[model samples]
Target: MLFRVDPASPVPLGDQIAACVRGAVAEGTAGPGDRLPPARELAGSLGVNMHTVLRGYQKLREEGLIELRRGRGAAVAGGASPGRARLARAARQVAEEGRALGMADEAILGLVRAALAAKGPPPLPGPGDGRP
Candidate 1:
Protein backbone atom coordinates (compact mmCIF):
# COMPACT_ATOMS: atom_id res chain seq x y z
CA MET A 1 0.00 0.00 0.00
CA LEU A 2 1.10 3.57 -0.59
CA PHE A 3 1.46 5.29 2.78
CA ARG A 4 2.03 8.98 3.37
CA VAL A 5 2.06 11.44 6.26
CA ASP A 6 2.14 15.21 6.09
CA PRO A 7 4.65 16.46 8.66
CA ALA A 8 3.37 20.00 8.15
CA SER A 9 -0.24 19.19 8.99
CA PRO A 10 -1.58 19.96 12.45
CA VAL A 11 -2.83 16.40 12.75
CA PRO A 12 -0.65 14.03 14.70
CA LEU A 13 1.69 11.83 12.70
CA GLY A 14 0.11 8.71 14.09
CA ASP A 15 -3.36 9.96 13.16
CA GLN A 16 -2.20 10.77 9.64
CA ILE A 17 -0.78 7.29 9.22
CA ALA A 18 -3.93 5.68 10.48
CA ALA A 19 -6.10 7.81 8.20
CA CYS A 20 -3.96 6.93 5.18
CA VAL A 21 -4.25 3.23 5.93
CA ARG A 22 -8.00 3.56 6.34
CA GLY A 23 -8.28 5.36 3.01
CA ALA A 24 -6.22 2.70 1.28
CA VAL A 25 -8.38 -0.07 2.64
CA ALA A 26 -11.53 1.81 1.68
CA GLU A 27 -10.22 2.23 -1.87
CA GLY A 28 -9.28 -1.50 -2.11
CA THR A 29 -5.57 -0.79 -2.45
CA ALA A 30 -5.22 -2.90 0.69
CA GLY A 31 -7.56 -5.65 1.82
CA PRO A 32 -8.02 -8.68 4.03
CA GLY A 33 -4.85 -10.72 4.65
CA ASP A 34 -2.59 -8.01 3.21
CA ARG A 35 0.35 -7.48 5.52
CA LEU A 36 1.45 -3.94 6.25
CA PRO A 37 5.09 -2.92 6.22
CA PRO A 38 7.01 -3.35 9.46
CA ALA A 39 6.90 -0.38 11.80
CA ARG A 40 10.64 0.24 11.67
CA GLU A 41 10.76 -0.03 7.90
CA LEU A 42 7.74 2.19 7.42
CA ALA A 43 9.09 4.77 9.85
CA GLY A 44 12.45 4.79 8.06
CA SER A 45 10.72 5.14 4.70
CA LEU A 46 8.31 7.81 5.90
CA GLY A 47 10.94 9.68 7.93
CA VAL A 48 8.88 9.33 11.10
CA ASN A 49 9.57 7.54 14.34
CA MET A 50 8.82 3.85 14.80
CA HIS A 51 6.65 4.70 17.79
CA THR A 52 4.41 6.81 15.57
CA VAL A 53 3.89 3.96 13.12
CA LEU A 54 3.25 1.56 15.98
CA ARG A 55 0.72 3.95 17.43
CA GLY A 56 -1.09 4.07 14.10
CA TYR A 57 -1.04 0.27 13.87
CA GLN A 58 -2.36 0.06 17.41
CA LYS A 59 -5.22 2.37 16.55
CA LEU A 60 -6.12 0.18 13.57
CA ARG A 61 -5.97 -2.87 15.81
CA GLU A 62 -8.33 -1.27 18.29
CA GLU A 63 -10.72 -0.35 15.50
CA GLY A 64 -10.69 -3.97 14.20
CA LEU A 65 -9.32 -2.83 10.88
CA ILE A 66 -6.00 -4.63 11.27
CA GLU A 67 -4.22 -7.12 13.50
CA LEU A 68 -0.76 -6.53 14.98
CA ARG A 69 1.45 -9.25 16.38
CA ARG A 70 4.95 -9.45 17.81
CA GLY A 71 6.56 -10.97 14.68
CA ARG A 72 3.73 -10.96 12.16
CA GLY A 73 3.57 -7.19 11.94
CA ALA A 74 0.16 -5.87 10.88
CA ALA A 75 -2.40 -7.26 8.45
CA VAL A 76 -5.70 -5.95 7.23
CA ALA A 77 -8.53 -7.65 9.15
CA GLY A 78 -11.37 -7.51 6.61
CA GLY A 79 -13.08 -4.72 8.51
CA ALA A 80 -13.50 -2.13 5.77
CA SER A 81 -16.02 -3.75 3.49
CA PRO A 82 -17.49 -1.61 0.73
CA GLY A 83 -20.77 -1.17 2.56
CA ARG A 84 -19.08 -0.04 5.76
CA ALA A 85 -16.94 2.35 3.70
CA ARG A 86 -20.05 3.86 2.13
CA LEU A 87 -21.61 4.40 5.55
CA ALA A 88 -18.41 6.00 6.85
CA ARG A 89 -18.32 8.38 3.87
CA ALA A 90 -21.96 9.27 4.40
CA ALA A 91 -21.36 9.98 8.10
CA ARG A 92 -18.47 12.29 7.27
CA GLN A 93 -20.68 14.15 4.81
CA VAL A 94 -23.37 14.50 7.45
CA ALA A 95 -20.91 15.89 9.97
CA GLU A 96 -19.54 18.36 7.41
CA GLU A 97 -23.02 19.52 6.48
CA GLY A 98 -23.95 19.93 10.14
CA ARG A 99 -20.83 22.03 10.75
CA ALA A 100 -21.55 24.16 7.71
CA LEU A 101 -24.95 24.89 9.24
CA GLY A 102 -23.27 25.94 12.52
CA MET A 103 -24.39 22.95 14.58
CA ALA A 104 -22.64 21.90 17.76
CA ASP A 105 -20.77 18.61 17.87
CA GLU A 106 -23.21 17.22 20.38
CA ALA A 107 -26.12 18.30 18.24
CA ILE A 108 -24.66 16.60 15.18
CA LEU A 109 -23.95 13.41 17.11
CA GLY A 110 -27.45 13.49 18.60
CA LEU A 111 -28.93 13.84 15.15
CA VAL A 112 -27.01 10.71 14.08
CA ARG A 113 -28.15 8.89 17.20
CA ALA A 114 -31.76 9.88 16.58
CA ALA A 115 -31.54 8.61 13.04
CA LEU A 116 -30.13 5.30 14.25
CA ALA A 117 -32.94 4.98 16.77
CA ALA A 118 -35.49 5.82 14.13
CA LYS A 119 -34.07 3.12 11.81
CA GLY A 120 -34.05 0.40 14.48
CA PRO A 121 -32.29 -2.93 13.76
CA PRO A 122 -30.55 -3.25 10.42
CA PRO A 123 -31.91 -5.72 7.91
CA LEU A 124 -30.50 -9.23 7.96
CA PRO A 125 -27.93 -10.13 5.33
CA GLY A 126 -29.24 -11.69 2.16
CA PRO A 127 -27.52 -13.37 -0.78
CA GLY A 128 -24.28 -11.70 -1.92
CA ASP A 129 -23.96 -9.70 1.30
CA GLY A 130 -20.13 -9.76 0.83
CA ARG A 131 -19.32 -12.01 3.77
CA PRO A 132 -16.24 -14.15 3.25
Candidate 2:
Protein backbone atom coordinates (compact mmCIF):
# COMPACT_ATOMS: atom_id res chain seq x y z
CA MET A 1 0.00 0.00 0.00
CA LEU A 2 1.16 3.52 -0.75
CA PHE A 3 1.02 5.94 2.15
CA ARG A 4 1.98 9.60 2.08
CA VAL A 5 1.92 12.27 4.74
CA ASP A 6 1.84 16.02 4.42
CA PRO A 7 3.53 17.69 7.36
CA ALA A 8 1.86 20.97 6.51
CA SER A 9 -1.72 19.79 6.64
CA PRO A 10 -4.04 20.93 9.42
CA VAL A 11 -5.22 17.37 10.00
CA PRO A 12 -3.42 15.32 12.64
CA LEU A 13 -0.70 12.91 11.51
CA GLY A 14 -2.50 9.97 12.99
CA ASP A 15 -5.65 10.78 11.05
CA GLN A 16 -3.69 10.95 7.82
CA ILE A 17 -2.29 7.52 8.57
CA ALA A 18 -5.74 6.20 9.37
CA ALA A 19 -7.13 7.60 6.13
CA CYS A 20 -4.39 5.90 4.12
CA VAL A 21 -5.07 2.56 5.75
CA ARG A 22 -8.78 3.01 5.20
CA GLY A 23 -8.20 3.80 1.55
CA ALA A 24 -6.02 0.73 1.17
CA VAL A 25 -8.70 -1.45 2.68
CA ALA A 26 -11.38 0.05 0.47
CA GLU A 27 -9.31 -0.34 -2.68
CA GLY A 28 -8.38 -3.97 -2.02
CA THR A 29 -4.72 -3.05 -1.69
CA ALA A 30 -4.83 -4.73 1.68
CA GLY A 31 -6.96 -7.84 2.11
CA PRO A 32 -8.49 -9.58 5.07
CA GLY A 33 -5.94 -11.26 7.37
CA ASP A 34 -3.11 -9.22 5.92
CA ARG A 35 -0.83 -8.06 8.68
CA LEU A 36 0.20 -4.44 8.62
CA PRO A 37 3.79 -3.45 9.21
CA PRO A 38 4.64 -2.97 12.86
CA ALA A 39 3.72 0.45 14.19
CA ARG A 40 7.32 1.39 14.87
CA GLU A 41 8.43 0.37 11.42
CA LEU A 42 5.62 2.24 9.73
CA ALA A 43 6.44 5.29 11.84
CA GLY A 44 10.03 5.15 10.74
CA SER A 45 9.02 4.79 7.12
CA LEU A 46 6.63 7.69 7.39
CA GLY A 47 9.08 9.80 9.41
CA VAL A 48 6.55 10.24 12.19
CA ASN A 49 6.46 9.12 15.81
CA MET A 50 5.53 5.54 16.75
CA HIS A 51 2.55 6.85 18.71
CA THR A 52 1.14 8.32 15.52
CA VAL A 53 1.10 4.95 13.83
CA LEU A 54 -0.34 3.31 16.95
CA ARG A 55 -3.05 5.96 17.07
CA GLY A 56 -3.96 5.17 13.50
CA TYR A 57 -4.12 1.47 14.25
CA GLN A 58 -6.17 2.18 17.32
CA LYS A 59 -8.71 4.12 15.29
CA LEU A 60 -8.96 1.25 12.82
CA ARG A 61 -9.39 -1.18 15.68
CA GLU A 62 -12.11 0.98 17.22
CA GLU A 63 -13.97 0.92 13.91
CA GLY A 64 -13.75 -2.90 13.79
CA LEU A 65 -11.64 -2.60 10.69
CA ILE A 66 -8.50 -4.20 12.07
CA GLU A 67 -7.39 -6.54 14.83
CA LEU A 68 -4.43 -5.71 17.04
CA ARG A 69 -2.53 -8.31 18.96
CA ARG A 70 0.34 -7.87 21.33
CA GLY A 71 3.60 -8.54 19.47
CA ARG A 72 1.68 -9.42 16.31
CA GLY A 73 0.83 -5.85 15.32
CA ALA A 74 -2.34 -5.16 13.30
CA ALA A 75 -4.16 -7.27 10.73
CA VAL A 76 -7.17 -6.65 8.58
CA ALA A 77 -10.31 -7.87 10.30
CA GLY A 78 -13.40 -9.50 8.79
CA GLY A 79 -14.28 -9.72 5.13
CA ALA A 80 -14.44 -6.74 2.80
CA SER A 81 -18.16 -7.21 2.46
CA PRO A 82 -18.80 -5.77 5.92
CA GLY A 83 -16.61 -2.75 5.24
CA ARG A 84 -18.30 -2.14 1.90
CA ALA A 85 -21.73 -2.33 3.48
CA ARG A 86 -20.76 0.12 6.19
CA LEU A 87 -19.45 2.57 3.62
CA ALA A 88 -22.60 2.25 1.57
CA ARG A 89 -24.73 2.94 4.60
CA ALA A 90 -22.69 6.01 5.45
CA ALA A 91 -22.96 7.32 1.90
CA ARG A 92 -26.69 6.79 1.89
CA GLN A 93 -27.07 8.65 5.16
CA VAL A 94 -25.06 11.58 3.87
CA ALA A 95 -27.02 11.75 0.67
CA GLU A 96 -30.32 11.60 2.51
CA GLU A 97 -29.31 14.38 4.85
CA GLY A 98 -28.13 16.54 1.99
CA ARG A 99 -31.40 16.05 0.16
CA ALA A 100 -33.37 16.85 3.29
CA LEU A 101 -31.46 20.15 3.40
CA GLY A 102 -32.53 20.82 -0.19
CA MET A 103 -29.15 20.16 -1.74
CA ALA A 104 -29.22 18.78 -5.28
CA ASP A 105 -28.10 15.19 -5.84
CA GLU A 106 -25.09 16.33 -7.84
CA ALA A 107 -24.07 18.76 -5.11
CA ILE A 108 -24.41 16.09 -2.46
CA LEU A 109 -22.28 13.66 -4.44
CA GLY A 110 -19.70 16.33 -5.14
CA LEU A 111 -19.36 17.03 -1.43
CA VAL A 112 -18.97 13.33 -0.73
CA ARG A 113 -16.27 13.01 -3.37
CA ALA A 114 -14.47 16.07 -2.01
CA ALA A 115 -14.55 14.76 1.51
CA LEU A 116 -13.12 11.46 0.34
CA ALA A 117 -10.33 13.28 -1.45
CA ALA A 118 -9.44 15.24 1.68
CA LYS A 119 -6.76 14.08 4.10
CA GLY A 120 -8.89 13.52 7.15
CA PRO A 121 -12.35 14.00 8.60
CA PRO A 122 -14.46 16.77 7.09
CA PRO A 123 -13.75 20.14 8.62
CA LEU A 124 -15.91 21.21 11.51
CA PRO A 125 -18.37 24.01 10.99
CA GLY A 126 -17.19 27.41 12.16
CA PRO A 127 -18.46 29.70 14.92
CA GLY A 128 -21.77 30.28 13.18
CA ASP A 129 -22.61 26.62 13.77
CA GLY A 130 -22.25 26.98 17.59
CA ARG A 131 -19.01 25.07 17.94
CA PRO A 132 -16.43 26.41 20.35
Candidate 3:
Protein backbone atom coordinates (compact mmCIF):
# COMPACT_ATOMS: atom_id res chain seq x y z
CA MET A 1 0.00 0.00 0.00
CA LEU A 2 1.28 3.48 -0.81
CA PHE A 3 1.11 6.12 1.93
CA ARG A 4 1.47 9.81 1.11
CA VAL A 5 1.41 12.96 3.23
CA ASP A 6 0.86 16.47 1.92
CA PRO A 7 1.88 19.16 4.39
CA ALA A 8 0.04 21.87 2.48
CA SER A 9 -3.41 20.34 3.04
CA PRO A 10 -5.52 21.65 5.88
CA VAL A 11 -6.16 18.15 7.20
CA PRO A 12 -3.92 16.87 9.98
CA LEU A 13 -1.18 14.36 9.13
CA GLY A 14 -2.68 11.61 11.27
CA ASP A 15 -6.17 12.17 9.86
CA GLN A 16 -4.81 12.08 6.32
CA ILE A 17 -3.04 8.82 7.03
CA ALA A 18 -6.19 7.37 8.50
CA ALA A 19 -8.22 8.53 5.49
CA CYS A 20 -5.79 6.92 3.07
CA VAL A 21 -5.89 3.63 4.91
CA ARG A 22 -9.66 3.74 5.00
CA GLY A 23 -9.85 4.47 1.27
CA ALA A 24 -7.40 1.67 0.53
CA VAL A 25 -9.48 -0.79 2.51
CA ALA A 26 -12.70 0.32 0.84
CA GLU A 27 -11.10 0.06 -2.60
CA GLY A 28 -9.53 -3.35 -1.84
CA THR A 29 -5.91 -2.14 -2.09
CA ALA A 30 -5.45 -3.41 1.45
CA GLY A 31 -7.31 -6.62 2.20
CA PRO A 32 -8.40 -8.33 5.35
CA GLY A 33 -5.60 -9.80 7.50
CA ASP A 34 -2.98 -7.61 5.84
CA ARG A 35 -0.31 -6.39 8.22
CA LEU A 36 0.62 -2.72 8.22
CA PRO A 37 4.21 -1.49 8.46
CA PRO A 38 5.48 -0.54 11.88
CA ALA A 39 4.67 2.97 13.01
CA ARG A 40 8.29 4.16 13.05
CA GLU A 41 9.00 2.67 9.61
CA LEU A 42 5.89 4.15 8.04
CA ALA A 43 6.54 7.51 9.70
CA GLY A 44 10.04 7.54 8.24
CA SER A 45 8.70 6.68 4.81
CA LEU A 46 6.10 9.46 5.01
CA GLY A 47 8.54 11.93 6.62
CA VAL A 48 6.27 12.32 9.62
CA ASN A 49 6.63 11.59 13.31
CA MET A 50 6.05 8.06 14.63
CA HIS A 51 3.34 9.40 16.93
CA THR A 52 1.42 10.60 13.88
CA VAL A 53 1.46 7.14 12.40
CA LEU A 54 0.48 5.66 15.76
CA ARG A 55 -2.43 8.05 15.98
CA GLY A 56 -3.58 7.04 12.50
CA TYR A 57 -3.38 3.38 13.42
CA GLN A 58 -5.26 4.06 16.63
CA LYS A 59 -8.03 5.75 14.66
CA LEU A 60 -8.29 2.75 12.34
CA ARG A 61 -8.43 0.44 15.34
CA GLU A 62 -11.21 2.51 16.87
CA GLU A 63 -13.12 2.19 13.60
CA GLY A 64 -12.74 -1.65 13.74
CA LEU A 65 -10.60 -1.70 10.62
CA ILE A 66 -7.40 -2.85 12.34
CA GLU A 67 -6.26 -4.81 15.36
CA LEU A 68 -3.16 -3.89 17.37
CA ARG A 69 -1.12 -6.64 18.93
CA ARG A 70 1.41 -6.20 21.71
CA GLY A 71 4.48 -7.26 19.71
CA ARG A 72 3.14 -8.03 16.23
CA GLY A 73 2.05 -4.48 15.38
CA ALA A 74 -1.14 -3.57 13.49
CA ALA A 75 -3.01 -6.04 11.29
CA VAL A 76 -6.13 -5.57 9.23
CA ALA A 77 -9.25 -6.97 10.79
CA GLY A 78 -11.37 -9.40 8.78
CA GLY A 79 -14.70 -8.17 7.35
CA ALA A 80 -13.81 -4.53 7.81
CA SER A 81 -16.73 -3.17 5.84
CA PRO A 82 -17.17 0.59 5.47
CA GLY A 83 -19.80 2.23 7.64
CA ARG A 84 -22.62 2.40 5.10
CA ALA A 85 -25.23 2.63 7.82
CA ARG A 86 -23.42 5.54 9.37
CA LEU A 87 -23.15 7.16 5.98
CA ALA A 88 -26.85 6.74 5.34
CA ARG A 89 -27.59 8.32 8.70
CA ALA A 90 -25.28 11.17 7.92
CA ALA A 91 -26.88 11.68 4.54
CA ARG A 92 -30.29 11.83 6.15
CA GLN A 93 -28.99 14.41 8.57
CA VAL A 94 -27.55 16.39 5.66
CA ALA A 95 -30.88 16.23 3.84
CA GLU A 96 -32.58 17.59 6.94
CA GLU A 97 -30.11 20.42 7.03
CA GLY A 98 -30.65 21.08 3.34
CA ARG A 99 -34.40 21.23 3.89
CA ALA A 100 -33.85 23.75 6.65
CA LEU A 101 -31.75 25.70 4.14
CA GLY A 102 -34.72 25.59 1.65
CA MET A 103 -33.26 23.02 -0.75
CA ALA A 104 -35.74 20.71 -2.50
CA ASP A 105 -35.51 16.92 -2.72
CA GLU A 106 -35.74 17.08 -6.49
CA ALA A 107 -32.69 19.33 -6.64
CA ILE A 108 -30.71 17.04 -4.32
CA LEU A 109 -31.65 13.86 -6.16
CA GLY A 110 -30.90 15.48 -9.52
CA LEU A 111 -27.46 16.48 -8.26
CA VAL A 112 -26.86 12.93 -7.03
CA ARG A 113 -27.93 11.47 -10.38
CA ALA A 114 -25.66 13.85 -12.27
CA ALA A 115 -22.73 13.00 -10.03
CA LEU A 116 -23.30 9.27 -10.57
CA ALA A 117 -23.52 9.69 -14.30
CA ALA A 118 -20.33 11.74 -14.38
CA LYS A 119 -18.36 8.92 -12.74
CA GLY A 120 -18.37 6.94 -16.03
CA PRO A 121 -17.78 3.20 -15.89
CA PRO A 122 -15.75 0.99 -13.58
CA PRO A 123 -12.13 0.61 -14.77
CA LEU A 124 -11.46 -2.97 -13.66
CA PRO A 125 -11.01 -5.27 -16.63
CA GLY A 126 -13.62 -8.00 -16.89
CA PRO A 127 -14.23 -11.08 -19.03
CA GLY A 128 -14.00 -10.72 -22.85
CA ASP A 129 -12.01 -7.50 -22.74
CA GLY A 130 -9.74 -6.89 -25.77
CA ARG A 131 -6.61 -6.12 -23.76
CA PRO A 132 -4.75 -9.25 -22.79
Best by TM-score: 1
lDDT of 1 by residue, 1-132 (tens): 888789899878997898777787788888888999999999999999999999988877766778887878899886656455445546657977999999999999999886775597865546786632
What are the clashing pairs of model 3? Answer: none
lDDT of 1 at 106: 96
Candidates 1 and 2 compared by lDDT, better number: 1
Ranking by lDDT: 1, 2, 3
Model 3 per-residue lDDT tens digits across residues 59-82: 778777888999999987885755
Q: Report the C-alpha lDDT of model 2 over 39-91, residue by residue, as the tens digit.
A: 89999999999999999889778767788999777898875444663684466
What's the lDDT for candidate 2? Answer: 0.78
- Better-scoring candidate (lDDT), 2 or 3: 2
Comparing 1 and 2 by TM-score, which wins? 1
Report the error of model 3 at residue 78, Å. 1.4
Query: Model 1 compared with the native: what TM-score?
Result: 0.71
Displacement of the residue 55 alpha carbon in candidate 1, Å = 1.2
